[model samples]
Target: MRILFRLVAAVATVLVGQTAVAEPLTLIIARAVAVPDSVSGQAMLSLKLTPDSGKAFARFTGANVGNIVDLSINGAVVTSPRIAEPIRGGEIMVSGTFKPGEVERIAERISAGDAKVEVDVKSE
Candidate 1:
């Protein structure tokens, strides 16, 4: 019975490995800013984009105005919302259902300048 179980597990692992893997989520961010919430005065983190990336995002949004874009962190999809308009200025406000530690982790990465978004001041 032990040998049979091992054989089954091996076959299952092989099959799983043969299956296709989904592409990881990618984000275009220039920097992240931590600020206070307006209502509750809690801490809030905002994602910003660099100038070049902002131009690219504007083009993409223009092309896919009605399409949904996935907002992710660490390859996990946090929200998939439809694009309402062209995203100019390259700033994204993250507000939604976020696990307590999840936002903290994101903030830590952003503060460390290790997140996918480039850390830079927006050129006005």
Candidate 2:
């Protein structure tokens, strides 16, 4: 009986190991162009992330996955706090707020082509 229990435990462990809840997510910066429309309220830019596959319940352990998000631009960058939410398949919704003149600032950065964005993600 003890041997049987041990075998069962081993099998369970193997199965669990094979199916980790977390996976590396690719954050591709789509377009960081500036928007000067008042309706959008400034500091607005078009952006996107790719290959988003993971379970929200699982933590973002830095062990398996290295970094969280990476940002690269050819122009200015407007800093703000962005939020990502799970979408259809392998996608997430990312939005944030920026400074009043954030859009113009980003434009200048991109024009200079010396600005790149990088973000880090780790286990909670």
Predicted candidate 1 versus true structure: per-residue lDDT over 46-76, tens digit per residue: 8777777677666666655666666656555
Ten-residue stretch with the least lDDT total in model 2: 74-83
Model 1, C-alpha of 6: deviation from truth (Å)? 61
Candidate with top lDDT is 1
lDDT computed for candidate 1: 0.63
lDDT of 1 at 58: 67
* TM-score of candidate 1 relative to the true fold: 0.60
Q: Clashing residue pairs, candidate 1?
A: 30-49, 30-118
Error of 1 at 91 (Å): 0.6
**Highest TM-score model number:** 1
Tens-digit lDDT track of model 2 for 36-71: 446655455544333332232123332334323322
Give per-residue lDDT, candidate 1, residue 12: 96
Score residue 68 of candidate 2 by CA lDDT.
33
